[model samples]
Target: MLANADHVMPDELKFEGDKAFFFAALDRADLIVHGRNSYEDQPNSPKRRRIIVTRKVGAVARDTENPNATLWNPHGAAFEAARAQAGVHTGTVAIIGGPDVFDMFMDRYDTFFLSQAPRVRLPGGEPCFDGVPARSPEQVLAAHGLKAAESIILDPAFDVSVTAWRRDNASSAARR
Candidate 1:
């Protein structure tokens, strides 16, 4: 949840501490997935395979600028097919999301890394999750049967921290 309450991710919300933590994690992912509006902040990372979820494309289409990226529409094409189109046959999938994209993958994530900048508050800005502001992001995650791991402080200077959420064995079994 990287935006303000108004569902807009303003430029001012980007925190350097969060980026360091986020980019490092992205390095371990085989494929990155995000909504059209949600993009990787690193522009220089070369050819990172990704899927851009969008409504503009009927199902799946090649991204104009990046050959490693495929535009996918959930309503038109199955996510499995899109993942394949992104050239990731197997390995971990990373979701860097906007609220709708996060909501779409509720059942599929093995882990969710939620980072917060405690000192910065966007009163009328976007919520991390769609149900946020109404029910906190933590509440939404709990409702989805995800258990939180210990929170780690990423950057003390900016007061940024991250928590990892994973479904318990029982919850995973139920999901399967």
Candidate 2:
């Protein structure tokens, strides 16, 4: 799943790196799972493929112009269903998320790819990952069942770093 913490009204579609990562991950899956907030925040564009998982069945509509996307609730069973679907592929199944959704699925995800903002600050907006206290993003991921798998510094212009983690299944102490 591709995600970022930005102002709610911000056009995240314009974020080149985030959007590029999102699309790249999308190409690996025939299905995409997203939270309601992220789903509702979608911009009008063609060639978008998505599925919205919400509490209500058919609670929202897909943009009329976005022919490739579909909406569904999965009644909070999106994880199981997505797992079933993704099991067919040895590739990845991303859980692109807003905070609530991330909080819900973080422990269950096999891995997480986080794009960290070292010094960037926002005025008023929800966080990228909720309930995680202010600390190094790496430390936060370690608190979950994740261990740093890779790290990359893209353009210095963005002041952002990309970090990847795979679930730590080795030991009980590894549940960070």
Candidate 3:
């Protein structure tokens, strides 16, 4: 997400580097999980398999319109079951998000790729994560045990950068 300094949703924010990185990651992954709103906003790509998390549905069901997609209500089915239903046996599962979906996998993510466009700011837009008040994306991810590992300036002209964070087990253990 190319959010502003306030960490609000970047509505229709388009960054070429971001798009390239996202699609490349999707290409390598076997399953993509995202919130309903996110799924709806994204353009249809039948080549990749997807699981759209939605509260409106009561069960996991294959999308009739898209053979590569599945509608999953996490309240009704376990994550593993949903993946199985989507025919994903073993492979990388990318969590593309809305705040709620990101929050749901807080502890499960081995790594997080955070991209930001510091020049842009969406004051009233939605946040990247829910239930966290007045926190930066890095702060939120750090609270969940991830530590910044590498930072890359994807576009120097726009001050757009991508930071990769990995789970810090030692820090987490120390906290306990």
Candidate 4:
């Protein structure tokens, strides 16, 4: 499990099919969003533009290290502003997770891709979403108004499957 908040992904959690699916989606995205803690060094990661959610800055700021990355604090500035800062005008936005970051965008997500690894269990490990272990990721997504679509098996060997939980826009509109 995690020795700290940003420990490397353990071998048990790695899924070849999931990685392929995720990176393919990311390749189609114009902008990517994730928390500082979830920063992963992919083969062409720096080549992809992204917005890094962090409290280190009060508002949107240019990432000193990566020219393609922008640091944003959702509390201080609007997402559109951050998007512009990240040079993403029109395209898909891929959100990589680390619990708190996913929670921040929970309400706005149109479709949440959930990959379940049934065999992998970490009693005290960090959850994919907040209030996990007790509430479960599915519960949290359902609580946030998302309904699962169809389950796609990523890896039959590992029994890893992914489901796209779509937000009910009609119900959301009524709630608003």
Candidate 5:
């Protein structure tokens, strides 16, 4: 996927609302790409084109139930190659991740959707992004020219929706 997302379940996501929408979107994706850790988190399941990006695993046998699943390592190139591959095969792509993966491709991402659970806090756990010092998700996206496009207050679960600043703006791209 040409985008990044971080979700805080229950609060930012609800079993009935946000989570339902999240998985439904995933189901509709032509390519579901995720980091190694995220891949491990999921119960091997079928439905979409699942691609796990990691250098550590080399490759793993496709989950019997999910024959469409496969794995590929971005191999230090971030996801240029993987993106190309996905483009050739499918139009829709989704990226689920660990921080390093997200940071690496955040700038080029066409959209970024973050589900923040306000008021609640985690004492100590994995960060949403790795290798970089603490930076608010909004700041990072702003630096990449991804401004908030939409925000929804879904009662039990309030989620902020963000898409690319503008889908076709070549000028907005942070030219290297």
Candidate 6:
């Protein structure tokens, strides 16, 4: 998510470095999980395997238009089962989000790359996490026992930065 210092309205992020970083991660991931809204927003994303989380039940199937995509209703199916159905047995799964999705995977994330554009502010935009009381994404991650590693300045001209929050006790298998 690309947000201002306030971490609001992450909908219209257009930072080149942020996009590059996200695509780089996507390139390395075997599966991608995201909310319905996020999936709809990225209509032209490269043809990679993806699972779209939704509340409606029994709609889990490969997208007819996009063969690499699946519509998953987690309420009706287990995550492992969904992964297996997607033919992803072992490899990195990147969770891109809407706030609810992020909150759902809070405990499962071994590392979260939070990109921020300090110069931009979206006062009424949606937050990174919706219901969490934490003031910032860092606080929310910290609550889940993740600590921030050194931040990378993705774009010095725009004061854009990406901070990685990693779980201290995450098992080696989880890292894989």
Question: How accurate locally is residue 171 in candidate 1, as Cα lDDT from 0 to 100?
Answer: 63
All candidates: TM-score: 0.89, 0.66, 0.85, 0.90, 0.68, 0.84
| Ranking of all candidate structures by their lDDT, best first | 4, 1, 3, 6, 2, 5
Winner on TM-score (4 vs 6):
4
> Candidate 2: lDDT of 115?
80
* Count of clashes in candidate 5: 0
* Model 3 worst lDDT window (10 residues): 1-10
Off by over 4 Å in 1: 5-12, 43-46, 173-176
> Which stretches in model 3 have alpha-carbon errors above 4 Å?
1-12, 40-44, 131-133, 169-176
Please list the C-alpha lDDT of all candidates, in the order they appear: 0.82, 0.57, 0.78, 0.83, 0.54, 0.75
Report the C-alpha lDDT of model 4 over 61-109, residue by residue, as the tens digit.
9999999999999889998999998878886788886677788889878
Q: Candidate 2 residues 45-139, lDDT tens each?
A: 23445555565544444434444544445554454454453333344445667666677766766678888655555545466676444655567
Q: What would the per-residue lDDT of candidate 6 be over residues 62-83, giving only the tens digit for each residue?
A: 7676678777887788788778
Give one digit per residue, the lDDT tens place, for model 5 in 4-112.
2333322322334545556766766677777765642334345456766666544343434456755566654444455554443546666667666677667666766
Consecutive 10-residue window with the lowest summed lDDT within model 6: 1-10
lDDT measured at residue 139 in model 1 versus the true structure, 0 to 100: 91
RMSD of each: 2.1, 5.6, 4.1, 2.5, 5.6, 3.7
Against the correct fold, how does model 6 do in TM-score?
0.84
Q: Which residue pairs does candidate 2 place in steric collision?
A: 1-94, 1-95, 1-96, 2-96, 142-176, 143-176, 144-176
Q: In candidate 1, residue 8 scores what lDDT?
A: 67
lDDT of 1 by residue, 86-157 (tens): 878888888988878898998777788888777777877767787778898889888887879978887888
Evaluate residue 165 in candidate 3 and report its C-alpha lDDT on the 0 to 100 scale: 89
Q: Candidate 4: where is the Cα deviation over 4 Å?
A: 1-7, 169-176
Cα error of candidate 3 at position 74, Å: 0.8
What's the number of clashes in each of the models?
A: 7, 7, 0, 0, 0, 1
